[model samples]
Every structure is written in structure tokens, then in C-alpha cells.
Target: MAEYAEITYTVEDRIATITLNRPQARNGYTVRMSDELADAFGRADSDEEVRVVVFTGAGDHFCVGADLSQGGFDFDGEPDGPWQEPAGRCAKRIFLMNKPVIAALRGAAVGAGITITLSADYRLAATDARFGFVFTRRGIFPEGASAWFLPRLVGMGTALDWMISGRLFGAEEARAAGLVQRVYEPDELLGKAYELAREIAASTAPVSVAVTRQLLYRMSGLDSPLPVHELDSKLIAGLPAHADSVEGVVSFFEKRPPKFTLEVGKALPAYLPWLDS
Candidate 1:
């Protein structure tokens, strides 16, 4: 299985790095790479020592999307009913992970690559990075929540413009539109990403960071800050009823950092704050 010649994972200094190792194919993603990525992110999410994840492709290209040569382009597989389809299952772990994920883009992020970058908590691109959502050109719709995440990041007008036109854009344009949080030289992309991840990992408690990430994800879908805050208030109120919140508050007043217990299993609160009244 290791002879597939794609996707690798390693950890250093609390950062789990998942590299798309298919440079020969411009780091195109195949089913093997998808499974590897799911496993890597799953481990990172469960490992307390691993506080952050960095995702990037090996060689010059970040990822040029799926390798159609591999016959995995249709996102097909066994279906355990409609709710358990392969396409959704493939990218569900990426969206559901509580750990912060940073994508380091040093080259082209096209098609599926664009979807992966959009899924990340923060995208750090090289100054020369190229991005394109070419799904329209291929006669396919955007997959892996790009339809939702892209518009949320860049707003409806810009998102529809890119999706419809499939125009290629550069780093500065991405930054201006808030698609990328930061840009650096090609050589500095990984280092800058690591610096940011380390800064956050070292200063923030892991549990708190994860919970804050959950809150942010929850709030991102709201229509306005008011609904977001309303949802946040309810969620925070529920959290205080848990033991972790009590410890967090007591430790705050005692001038000591809080060490929270991780009890967040598959229980995610359903808070739809986007309904217009």
C-alpha cells in the first residue's frame, strides 16, 4: 500500500504535517491520498499532544486536484444508503475535526485543492501561489462544502463570480478577498505556517482552543453577528453546566491557567442562527 506513491504524515513539536506526496502528478489527490488524509487528521484530532495540523503538497504544486487517471474522479464507492455516501464521507472528517488545520500553499491550488484549502481553518499561501476553482470547466459542481465555505469566506458576489467563471487568481487577490489569511515567499510558506501554529498552540490551552474552534464554526454560518452571539451565549451557558467550565472559571480567578477535560464526543449542538424573523 505504501508503494502508491502519495500522501505522507509526520509530527514535530506538536504540529502534525500531512503532505500530499504525489509531485509526479502535480500532487493530484487519489482515493489513497484521501484515505491517508482522513487517517492523519483523525489521529491529530484525537492526540492531545498534537495541537495543530499543517497540510500541504510536496514539490512545487500544492495540489492540482484529483488525478482523473486513477479513475477516482467520480467520488464513487460503496453506498450504505444515501446518508452514508462516499463523497460526503471522504471529506466529513476534515470538516468535523476540532483541531485547527492550516494549509500551506506554495503552488497551484486548483479544483479539489481549492476545496481542501477552503476547508482549512486558515490558509497560508506563498506569494506566487495560484488558485482556481475549475469545477465548472470540468462540468462538475464544487464538492466538499466549497459551495458553502467559499461563499462564506468571500461573500456571495465574489464566490459566484469565481465559481461561474473559474478564473485563476493569485496570492494578493486571494488575500484581498480574505481567501488566504497570510502570504509569504515560496521558501517561507511552511516556516510561517509553523510559526503561526506554534504561537497558537503554545499560548492557548488545547481544549479551549478546540472549543473556540467549534464556536467559530458554529458562528460562521449565521446571517449576522447578533444571531451568532445569541447562539454563542446559549452554547456557553450550556458549557458552564459542565465541569470543565467550572474549572476554567475557578482557575481564571486563582491566577492559574485552566486545564480542561475533553468530554466533547460526537455530541455537537444544533444551533441554526440564520433564520430570518
Candidate 2:
């Protein structure tokens, strides 16, 4: 129910679209913008009707890093209170969401623009999109846990090249390095994003997608497969009794789109190890 000024949120056909709305400023990054983004994502996460999220910006450029119009980044901090980096506020919220997120980027998606989308489930970039890990160039450290995420998305060597050098790269290079899922024409970007989101919304179970997203992000980092196997066994053992699981099987054999009824807000397994985390 929170109102947002820096972004806009709308849902259609079960997919929530969260758009950065400062087109006049090229969706420049600011603390207020980050706060709104986190709030909007939380709203989407809690809405049971929202099955997937399509994140994007409303302008020729997605985001042009931080707003330096005042000759420095627009930021806020309290010496007497706790604070977190701007980009991390959005990235972490998206990471915790029960639904999948697809980021559609075009034009300049440099600095915070690219970093903020690191935790998104899928990143679809426009042919003209440009990306950068320009923190070092700005004399700032990684803001969105990119140090941990970038290396995992690409390899350590590629991460080092992007993060350390702080150079802007094109969409094709980003796709080649696996930083983005795919590249499309600027005119086709959002269509592609929505297409993929619709496919997921129509075919996948909400609870299953939530569980799979969480398990993959959390367990993939463990030192051993033994623990993952233990958790996987537990997850699979309960599947037969889950309503969505039953529907999945029936629809698969019937060769039709599934009508999964499970909702992430209520149907997630109580035994999930990281439920509290």
C-alpha cells in the first residue's frame, strides 16, 4: 500500500512491472530512488497475484549510474544510526523475493544500473545497452554485493576485468561473459522480457519457482554437494503430496498448460531450512 514517487509498479496477467520513472534524469541513481525500489519490490513479493516481475526503466537510458548533478552523489547517512549502500537496498530485496525477476535494460546500464540487477533471475539487454562495473573509477567500492555475485555470474577472470578496470562494455560482450541472459533490439527488449515472464506465469507453479530460486542461490554456494543432496532429498520427498506437484504431473501427461494453484505467500514448505534466514 506504500506510495512510490521514484518508480512505478503495475501488474498485468500476474506479472508485476516495476519501472524506474525518472526519464528526465535518465533514471539517475539516488538514495530516494533506491528506497522506493526496495519498497516496490517488497510490495510485489508479498502480493500473491504477482507471479513474476519485469524490472525496467522508463527512458532512452535505463540508468546512468549515480546522480552527480550536485557535483557529487545524492546520498544520505546517519552517523548515529545504521545505514546500507544504495544499490544493495534494491539488490537484496529482489534476492529475497518469492517470485522470479527479469530485468530489461537498454542504453546505458552502467555502475549502479548494472549492479542493481545482479540478483535478478534473468537480465535481458537491448542491442545498444552498455554496462560497467565502474565503482573503482568512481572511487567507490562495490555497492550491491557485486564482488560476490559478479564472479559467480561470469568467471573470476572476467569479474576481475570488469570490476578492477571499471570500463564500459557492450551488450554482446556482456552476453558473451554471461553477465546478461540475452540481447535483443531496443524495440524488442520489453516484449522479450514479457514473453518470458508470461511463459513462466502460465506454466510454472509459484511455490515451486520460489523454492527453486531460493535453493539454487543459497545452496549453490555451499562447499559440498552432500548438504545440497540432503536438502534436495527432503524437498523431493514432499513433492508428491503438494497440490502443485500433483497438477504438474497431470498436466504433463495431458500435454496441456498447467493450472498450478499454489501461492508462495502460503504454500512454501515449513521445513525449508532458510525460512528464517
Candidate 3:
């Protein structure tokens, strides 16, 4: 079993709980964590018994974005290059998944953390939860599609406020700003998110839910951007199969870490519309 450095996933009662497993660093993501999450989500998506997903941090914080310990990616080295695979898989895969995802946010949800929360179908934050877009402060442009997704969720003005300022907001402020769906006491957050997830799982029809998700994402793309889902998924599926996807599935059933193959992205079909019948 390949041990994951920063994520843990378990399935029960048709729901998967994906925990950001790095409390020592406030659940900060590394390239490793990003890959691990994408692989975990792939397993949950393929499992017929797993209909709902609840994302939460292992300890106090949900996530504080990328690991400062590891520093940031060298995006300048290549255009449309090496970094794109892991980066896209982490954020884009979560955003594009057909299954319902509910974020149970506690402590800090900064940078990519906040972006992922925005991508979720529902977000339940602790009263003390902290949210920020720390990219600008860190001297980099937002890479996690916040430039595209945030405005759609909260409109242009508010998106400008967050993205440009990189301001951190408390949970109440986050809820008021429309960053979170609801706020609960810190202790109540997990239960409330789980409750909401169960409600959604019980109420939504499977195939219909998937189709609706597809439509929502498709419609959210900008006029200038490519039809993102078709292109993104084509790229993901074309990758040399990560050992993690198989290990992740087997591990969920047996409770183990995934041994993964090295990353590789191969050619795939063009990004195009689903043909109307």
C-alpha cells in the first residue's frame, strides 16, 4: 500500500469522506496532495455505491492552500507544460466531477482551498472558518480557475474585491459575501455538512444529478474559453493510468495508501460538444 502524505478517504453508507490529512501544516496541499485528491475523487466517482462526497480537514483547518514548505510551482519554465497536469487535475477535476461534493470547512480555507470550496455544490463553514485568496499576496496570478469561477459565483465586483486584495474573511463575513452556503458553530460544521450531503444524496436521482452537473459547468465557462470539460476530461483520461486510481479504489475497500505510477499525459480526442441526438 502506498501511503498518502496528506489525504485520507473512506466510503460508508454510499458517501465518501475525503479528509485533508495534514494538520501539522493546517492541511496545506503539496503537488502530492493534489495528485492524491484527484485519484481519490476518481475512485469515488467510479464507485456505484458512493453517491455523495464530503470534504473536510483531518484536524483543525480545512486547507491553507499549497504547502509553503514545498514552495510554489515553476510555471515560468514551460507554457502549456509539465505543471499543468497536476494543477488541472486537482482543481479542475473537483470542479468537473458529476457527483455531489459538500465542503465541511473549519479553520482556514485560503487560496486553492477557498477555490475548491467555491467549486463544491454546498459549503458549510465553521463560525470561525477563515477564507482568503492568497495568490495576489504571494506575488502570483491565480492559477486554480478563480479568475474564471469566482465571478460566476459571486459576481464581478465581489470577485474583484477578493482576488485583488487577497483579503482574509471570517466565516460570518464569508457567508454574508456569499462565499459559504451556511455557517455553523465550529463543532457543528461536520455534522451539518454531513446532514446536507445525506439530504442531497437521498433526494437527487443519480443519472439526472450527473447530467445537471455537466450542464452547470458547461454553462459557466466564459465566451472566450474553450469548452473546458470536454478538453479537461479528455486530457485526464488520456493520462497513463496513475497507480493511485487503482490503489485508491482498493485502499478504500481495504484501508491502505495507493502506490502510483509516475505522471504521464497522452494524446486524446479533441475538446468538443456532446452531439445532440
Best by TM-score: 2
Tell me the tens digit of each residue's lDDT in model 1 across 63-117. Answer: 8887887554644466466633223343567677778899999788888777866
TM-score of each: 0.80, 0.97, 0.75
1-277: candidate 2 lDDT, tens digit per residue: 3688889999999999999999999999999999899998999999998999999999889999888888986659563567788999999999898899999999999889989999999999999999998988988888888888889999999999999999999999999999998999999999999999999999888998999999999999999999999988988999788999999999999999899887788888888888989
Clash count list over all predictions:
0, 0, 0
Off by over 4 Å in 2: 77-80
Q: RMSD to native for every prediction? A: 4.6, 1.2, 10.8
State the TM-score for model 1.
Answer: 0.80
145: Cα error in model 1, Å:
1.5
Deviation from native of the Cα of residue 147 in model 2, angstroms: 0.4
Clashes of 2: 0
**Model 1 segments beyond 4 Å from truth?**
1-5, 70-90, 222-277
Task: Note the Cα lDDT for every prediction shown.
Answer: 0.77, 0.92, 0.73
Model 1 accuracy (lDDT, Cα): 0.77
Model 3: per-residue Cα lDDT over 82-137, one tens digit each = 55634455667677676889889988888877776567788888988988987789
Greater-TM-score candidate between 2 and 3: 2
